[model samples]
Target: MDPSTLFAVAPTFPMDDVRIRDRSRETMLRSPLTWLPLLGAGAMGFALDAGVAGFVLLLGATVALVSRYWKKRRPAVDAASLRELIGESNAAQDQELKRIIGSLESKGLPQYSLCLGRFLFLKQKIEKDVHRGQHFAVFAQEVEKGVDGICAEVCREITGIRAREERLGEILTSRQPTQLERLESARRESHAAILHAYTSLYQVHAEILGLGSDPTERETVEDPGELPGQRLQEILGGLRDEADMIARTHARIRRTIEECPPAVEAPRPEVVC
Candidate 1:
């Protein structure tokens, strides 16, 4: 392996809206530190025949219950499971991005390859941000549902594309006009499908990053869409390592997809503009 061979970073999607913090707040509200004393206070008031005080305590308890009901935050996860899944998701996305990069390189579209790399870096930065106590949920639930399934679909779609390309390869000995048109049509459709896959991939990244705020109202934070030309060239050059790692890494990712459990398909995102 090359010294700079890609390694795993924690894959995180922007799931800031998943209510992890809400659940934490609710948990603390329900903990013994708050409710247990309230219960004790209520009991003591009743024991002393302090009817009005007991009613007040009961009212406080009712408020607490009502607060919990109103929040109704969900997708709660314990700390351990949360951490484990985060690590797993990080690995899955890392591998999948590698595969995508390799496929893009093969298609002679270095700019798109670099675009995806920058997006992956943005995702890595999110994980780093959360780790540094920024918008973090020590007990946050998984963000962006169906992430694994969407990644798996990307893998499956590329696999089909590769198979079709090979079939086309076997029949192209003739220079006949009809054969050339058929091949040209297949190539066009294949590129379109690849573009669609990339569009969905970018959407997944955007949702995880929570870039939903109005750009006109405020200066948006860093964007991967407008990656600088020189920087993109640098990224593409970086992908070409001494060890020829792309084929090996892509193969490993493909084998992983085949060996893993069946992926549940989610509704595909529309092609981005």
Candidate 2:
């Protein structure tokens, strides 16, 4: 997979949408046109201020206008709040990835370890590239999301494989051959899934490494055989196929078990008198 193709398939986070909404709200708030109604109300109140009621109305309108103006102009407050939220979410995700990787490392899973090392290297490269310009930030985020997804899926499949192995071990001493076979099959499938994920991650890393930091440079570079968008679609299709295969395997196992007769324990011989 080309780095551009990987980027095209990267998952989108809600942060961009949130940022857009914040900017729109800020723009609307800062516009003088938005405050016109308040100004008109204040003017009307001031015009009628011949008694206590009028004075109170004018005071209230003045307070409201001032409060709104202060809030609209205080970009630091809004920006800080948004930044804090985003920072917290990012921190939580980072912590989760660390925890997952740590668990895998403790288990001495070499494949996961190798993938983690590669991911860390890729992450560093992404950060460095993102620093080159504001435009790269979006791409960096997308790639981060993609890599994060790969890590998560890898962890999940590995965990499933481990669980299945443990189950198989437990069932080994039992007479439930069907159950044992089902677990063994599931474990094999999980291993295959992990291999697929690893391949995808490696491909993505290679492509990302080839990416230029400059957006203009990226625009000039193109593959005539496959557009980035189409490649992404293919990647997604492959993932769906893998998922479908796993689901079908599980369903087949379930059907087989349902059709099989329950295992019966051998009766003990009668005791001697």
Candidate 3:
């Protein structure tokens, strides 16, 4: 995979009015100015010995008043500020992608580039779909996290491969028969671990692609079918399992390499008298 794929043009959709409304509502709901006054009104009604019915009426009035006040006083969601925040977030993600790709390139592991490329491609695709709905926006963030995890797993696999190669080189040069046998076993185990990681990554990639392919699937549903978010969680969960396996395999190989004794010189054969 070409590292340049990571720099694919981000979707340029302007935040729609619906999304803006959603954002404003979310912000307003979280602010003390929205809820604290309601609480205060309730307290005042109780302190004044208002009956339950009266208190309820007072609280209802307070809500209407609060709503009207908020409608006028709430600051508009500044488009420029939102764009800046998104730009900053995208910049950070880009930096991380570059860091991962740089490490892979430095380690001469270009073979894994395809995995990274597919990840970025799917990520951008999902972002475009997510822009269509406020409900889907959270999935965009989840997708980012999932891609980050897959990229990290790819890096770990590359590191493990490099380490395995070095360890094998040491064992081969040592010319110890026992170590040679152990080396073969380690190679098989490492290969299996790498395969497992790739399988997990491919599964995640396919699932993400599925999300982008079907509009129906992407819809927030209340029925029996799986939700996009739930599927995403499963994908991330698989990636986590693969990561754990890679870590364990790496540690095991390192231990094997370290524990293998240095080459012992063979004693000379004595001639019979």
Clashing pairs in model 3, backbone N/Cα/C closer than 3 A: 1-114
Give me the displacement of residue 182 in model 2, in angstroms.
Answer: 2.2
- Model 3, 106-171: lDDT tens per residue? 667676555555544554554445445455455555544544554455455555555556666666
Residue pairs in candidate 2 whose N, alpha carbon or C atoms collide under 3 angstroms? 3-207
Q: Give the count of colliding residue pairs in each prediction.
A: 2, 1, 1
Candidate 2: residue 210 lDDT (0-100): 41
lDDT for residue 255 in candidate 2, whole number 0-100: 63
Best prediction by TM-score: 3
Candidate 2 per-residue lDDT, tens place, 1-273, comes to 112111112232556656645755665566665576667766776677647777677667766776786677566555555445545555565555566566667777667656655554554454344334443343555555555565545544555455445545446656778777766676666667656655664554444444433445556665656544444434444543443444455455446545655545567899999
For residues 91-202, could you state the per-residue lDDT of candidate 1 as single tens digits?
6777767867776677665765675566456455544443333233421233222233333333444444454445454445433345445545544554454455445434
What would you estimate as the lDDT of candidate 1? 0.47
Q: Which regions of candidate 3 deviate over 4 angstroms? A: 1-90, 93-96, 99-109, 112-132, 138-141, 184-195, 212-230, 264-273
lDDT of each: 0.47, 0.54, 0.61
